[model samples]
Target chain A: MEEDENIKKLNPVEMKLLTHIIKNEWKTLIRGKWVIGYGLIFLILTDTLLRFGGGGAEVLLSLSNVMLLFIPLVGMIYGILYIYQSREFVELLLTQPINRKTLFWGLFCGISTPLMAAFVVGAMLPLGWHGILAQDPGASVMVLALGGMLTLIFVALGFVLGLAFYEDRIKGFGFTIVIWLFMAILYDGLILMAIFTFGDYPLERFVIAATMLNPIDLARIMVLLEFDISALMGYTGAVFRQFFGTNSGILTASGMLVLWLAVPAWIGLRVFKKKDF
Target chain B: MNNYKPIQLHLFGGLILLLLAWTSVSEASASDTAADIVVSPDGPVVSIQEAVNMARPGDHIRVEAGVYVESNIMIDKKLTLEGIGYPEIDGNLEGHILIIAADSVTVSGFFLKNSGRSHVRDYAGIYIDKAKDVVIENNRLDNIFFGIYLSATERGVIRGNEIRSYERRESSSGNGIHLWNVKDPKILDNKVEGQRDGIYLEFAKGAEISGNRSNNNNRYGLHFMFSDDSVYRGNTFNKNGAGVAVMYSKNVDMIDNIFENNWGTSSYGLLLKDINDSRITGNRFYRNTVGIDSEGSNRVIVHRNDFELNGWAVNIKSSSRENQFTENNFIENSFDVRTDSPRNPNHFEGNYWSHYEGYDLNRDGIGDVPYRPVRLFSIIIQRQPESLILLRSMFITLLDTAERIMPVLTPATLIDEKPKMERIR
Candidate 1:
């Protein structure tokens, strides 16, 4: 009976934390006038202009490839920042006799609330627009799920970054930028250089392993290659085909992206639990 | 005695069961081989190669639109593998679509993935290793180790194929369409990207690499090393890794190609290293890091080409000699020429430079005043790249003008006399 009672109460801590986060998320969105106003305006203007730009819909779909990457990245940063900045609130909650783990989990949910809202809004645009343009439900869902996964990943990332540099926002932001650049440009550049200079020797296995490390590259290639094999039917396309052409490659990539989401969140939670702030 | 009795009974029962199971398993496997073969739109064979096994030569195997988990599909004979609605031939997480080790094979209209990518084994979607007369066309190769690999194979036509890769890690990736140690092949009108190179040739001789758009690739759009007597015409190589590098190759002609917008600090439109007796004529280079970058290249005739708005119109290192740049248009570029060697490795004659301000007094097409192509500011920037921020300033403009007037503080030997005032077109 005692064991049963403990089991029943085990999830209460998680529930309470989750509820607190959800409530805080609403508050942040209501107060986050600048982020909402600016970000929406920029997205709308760019999206509308792109719609008229011929092959804009496809390009939009392609650009939405970042949804999986940036959403997780940005959301993670924003969530961690919110929790880090609200140290006084966290301390007040700690004084209320709530468990430290519960408080951190609550903070996690609260920060993620804004990111979730933004994600839904961001995803809807692509879906609605794609529906209007191409009447493609499959494409729309793919795009939306892509966006959703991205948001979760980034929100988790934000948490990790925030927790990692709780005392230094500048350092955290700088590190994020460096990571973004590495994933976006530098990594690809380096990869190309290697492939070109070492064409004689076979190196496909290494390329596949390298691709598993970057979430953005993984999502972009997965979506693109899944939709149209022709999209990557090039030099590097061959490498992609070799790795992701099978259920195994897809599974591995998906597994890696999932890890990218889970590991960061886990780390952030660990940090949030131990940190004085 | 008591322990032995229980053990003997257990062993006797186990032996009998094992014999029974072995016979049943063999029968089941034998039956499965015959009944496991399926053909349908949705509940079709789990793999294309499995479908291939059920198919005879000249059989039209129609595959549906879904993901099939398979790998190392060996097509040993001639067949038509067609996807009804682009059924994905997945290499079962890590598999190759159709590795054709035999000749006279034709693969078309299916999404081929996972072509046996090994640093050791040359895996390809339609790999013709030492096979001949293969026709691979109209197939979309995605994320393959190699789109269509032909090694030591001859008389194959790879046309209307789109091979691409997004995994841009250097040392361990494959090319779009790789032809190694092959001779007399025709590769035409393929759009390949995201690979090491779009169309790569290693020791591939007497082949025509024409009418292909290879862009956004990790390496060169078209790369040929030690591949000689080949013709690359009407190819567009844009935004690739180092553009197109043809090294240790001879008697090659690169004509009517657009090598442009390949702007990396160390990239070039066309990099010819240690190439001998090559003809680069009627080629257009626009907005590349260095158009026609030649190092240790000799006896090359470059004429009637447009080198417009590149970072450096012509980059000839000291090792290059007796190469000619004639009737080429150099317009609105930062540097007309760049070289480490003190002496002129190549001659520049009758080329149009946008900065050329000279009169044709004799009414000849060539300008009367000699045009010094190298600017002193460019030299300064070469030595100290940070000084590029001073570009287009009054000081830089004045310094360049002075350098052009006197030829001092600039490489005097790097002058293009008889500079045409207009484009050769």
Candidate 2:
């Protein structure tokens, strides 16, 4: 029975209902103001701290990396947690003519817009306020492109988190925080301890793999190191120098961040497609 | 009469149509081509604010040479303010000259000075707040509290500016250039001096600080905290109270810089505190109290540098771990390396210790005997600090010799296994 349910084809009517559901989700996000406000405050504060706080560039960059996970996580909670509470809107959309796939993409795009806006505006601030483009226009462009991709990845993550617990808002919120905490802080701490314990021998190779797995680490390696993989080719950096310290490593890491966005989103769509309203 | 009437009517119609087309074209051109306003003797409005008022989007404002006494000049339009002959701008009582609220504005070639002092608030000369694509370059700032402040501003190039603050009595003052919540900033080739800190960064990302001179500051030449993933290269820091302090930051690369003459009772060429996963390579350190004093620093690689005439080459304090020091030259220093505690988690190898007295028996360029960098007197001085006054004394030399012979009083972990008998280069 489970296998049959898994293989069950969506009829035209169900597909249409799914499309309506996603469309309503998108509309709801566009009309909301929470994501914009959060992004605005974050950008303003980050800029202030960097410009006048007497801290150096490394501190600011690292801080920005930690903040990357929060925007999408919060956006997901706001988008998905309210689905059940949005009973009338969901019912009204279900009564329309659309498919689940359409609904998934529509909802994804709808909720992702504000997050994307926040990313663009936030990213643009560094380019202008710092005037990095005037010195190296090429680097500024590269940062912008990377910023755009990173924003999309985070926003898609929100969709997955949102869909995973549309049924239970509290559990979903808890799950998002856990995932963020694991990725941002706990995972690295555990990796460092492991390295210290077993790192008497040549064990940096394993540490490199573990660091690359974390999105925050990968993003940092890709951006801060830029294309100078040779600089990373030292004792501890040798492993990073060998892997993400190279051209192939940068490409692979970027591909990984993209996968992080796509896989979760696909899973969320699958769940949303089968979810009974 | 009939011929005249037809000709007159046709001519009148043609004239009317011509006039209509001419007016339409003029309006179209006027909407597209914005006005260029000059802020000097040539044009109206001697102050920067007046020029800002006259400017529309996509306009250029030229500022002439003269001391313009103003504060909080708002730039709300996309314009270029190119100063000729470096106009002196003094920010009296209120702070932050040329506050940019609009994007794509350029403030270049101005001698900015005398910003307002505030204990509670840090002020700036050219403050770009929440603006984008701003260029602040080739400007001279004197007695400025904070120069080229950035907040949430991106794609900025703070290049070729001479920023210097006077020696203020208060600790809160100084910082030649500052950045906060900033991203993708290129702070290149700027000379900063006489401030509490030459350059400071916080919560910024994707930044490159290169080819800058930071000297004669009361505090750190370059101070970084809680930041990550940044590159600093080809910068010279000299004669500061402390040279380059990096704290609570990670994934950083520092290369090809000279750290010199930062001498004090307690100071270093570079101070690494709670730093992790960083690379320090090809940097020269000379005539400083301590070269690279690291505390609670982890997972760092220090290699390929010249250390000359420093009081102590490297000082490793407590809780520093997993660091490797290699391929560095330690020449003419009173002490090569010293530590406070008896135990150390770091490893040192392949460094050329000039004070190594061991003979190379195997002809493999490596000394047969292990080189002890930390002397008993060095440890005692580290503990009592005041004992440093006895440096180079005959008594301390005898004590060091005794400790070297016995190897009991000095920390067992503070020895270099493969110290080079001769200099590599």
Candidate 3:
């Protein structure tokens, strides 16, 4: 009777917030046929590529390339557009008996969960059918986890940008695209130039630090290390092996990825708290 | 006619008398004092030195099964030193166990061990100096500075000997079979391991090394310097610091040898430096860092060899030219060919590459399109080694595909015009 009383004494506002987020996220995902269509396309492309290319590790590598290029773009664009399209809906929800934190989190989860679900279902179905998980569980799991982390990070970043420029949809979408472009393409080019420009000094530690700054390079290095091509890695690879070879390195990288997730979401929530509807 | 007959008869009589005198003199010398001296613990002669001192030229001294702590036992006459039951000759870490300085010497069936260690001199288990027609066979040498040292010796046969040492560093250990300024030495069926080099030949000519298994040495399995007209066949060299190195030699034939498991940062199956007019054929190089690292070598024919799972099947330096690589099977290597320079002067034809993607349009057992083994990424790696971490990346793959479609960065001349459609068995 005491346990039952303690359960009944829970905050009703939290319960209502959970239910509202689940209901809204589900409705949005069902209404958007393009999301389901893109998911099916991803599944077919991964399956076909795996079937034709060499199996297991090669498939994981190919999928990583696609994820690094397409996932952030899809997540960011969908995030900003969802926020703009649901502006009236969010305004209507704000008139209800809920706090700003609950409303912000509900909307953020409502937008991000469906995109994450689409990616997971699209990628995991093909990967499971091809027995990639059985062949190389470590690399497969790492690739999937990295993909998930990238989706969350970019979606949260999209929210931060969307909430900051709430009045101008063009500016919000434009900033999201630019950030994705910078992260995916231009960042690696700049890193390569830096490494080449300062080729004389020992740049092992510097390269590792630079890779951590970009999540895509971090995921790429993690996958490459799993391939055990250290013989071709030369000196910098040796340094990476010495450092990232331990469990501590993996822990640090994972923690940093989590931090990448948390910081943007916190900033987006702060922006939501002060926004004038 | 009569005068010629008398002169011929006199010449014949003189020849017969000379032959009779020679026979009598040889018989007298053979019967005079060249006795079989037996040295045993219970025999009249208990020491080998005493037996050797008491013997004359063409005599046989047999040492029985006992530990003879003797060093610098010089054989200055045409003598036969035979061990009756594999006697142990210990040098006690002093000097060479046995030294043969005369011609027609035979030292066989002994267990020789523990020669002195000196940086100044190469003490050996069996040292042959300025000798000809010397046969040093059926002996086991252990824990010696040099196992069998042949200096200024010719026509020496070193066969069926096992030489080993326990030295870890190359600076302190000597070679198992060291030949210096020797000619026509036949090294056959010797098993050498755990030495500086399994076999070292310098300034030697017309040597034939066959059927030897050299493994786990500190330095090279077999090293040759300025040794010309030498042929080494049917040898197995495995897991050495660096496999067989042939430097500054010409007209050498390396055939049917198995060079395997020599994997390190700077190791190779066979390293050729400044070698010309050599034929390396029918050999198998498996799992080496580099199968054949050729530098400044010319006119070499590398044919019908199998290179499997090596880091680089053939790493040819730019200084090497005019070499022919034909009918070789390159299977499952990380990189088929890595050259330092973009300009290729050598010929690579009719080799079966496992990564070849071209089809045989005319059914002639050769691909219609030529195959380029060197990738543009490999060129990038040559410039910036750290860029290898980006291997198999999308951007690099795109760059490679673009370069392949339009031959831009990779050298156009480094193509195998006749790649084999089927693997060469």
TM of each candidate vs. truth: 0.54, 0.56, 0.64
Q: If both were scored by lDDT, which would come out higher, candidate 1 or candidate 3?
A: 3
For this target, which candidate reaches the highest DockQ against the unseen true structure? 3
DockQ scores of all models, one per candidate: 0.01, 0.01, 0.08
Residue by residue across B1-425, what tens digits does model 1's lDDT show? Answer: 68799889999999999999998985774463332234444663566767878767655556667777777778777665666566677664354567776667766667777666678765666677787778777888888877788889887888888888777876677788999999888998989989888888999989998898999888778889998899989999998977889999999999999997786656789989999998998988876768878889999999999876676788888899999888888765656787875578679899987667687887777898888887887676555442332333334555688778877677678778788855578
True contacts kept of each: 0.00, 0.00, 0.05
Report the Cα RMSD per candidate: 21.9, 27.2, 11.3
Question: What's the distance in Å from true for residue B51, model 3?
Answer: 3.0
Worst 10 residues of 3 chain B by lDDT: B26-35
lDDT of each: 0.71, 0.72, 0.82
lDDT of 3 by residue, A128-238 (tens): 888887877887888877887888888888788888888998899889888877777677667667767987887767877877787666666665555433234223356
Q: Once superposed on the true structure, which residue ranges of model 3 sit more than 4 Å away at CA?
A: A1-194, A206-277, B1-37, B41-44, B58-60, B84-86, B391-395
TM-score, candidate 1, chain B alone: 0.85
Tens-digit per-residue lDDT, B103-175, candidate 2: 8888889988888777877778888888888888899988777777888888788889999877655386668
Best by lDDT: 3
DockQ score for model 3: 0.08
Of the two candidates 1 and 2, the one with more favorable DockQ, higher being better, is: 1
Runs in model 2 deviating more than 4 A are A1-277, B1-35, B383-386
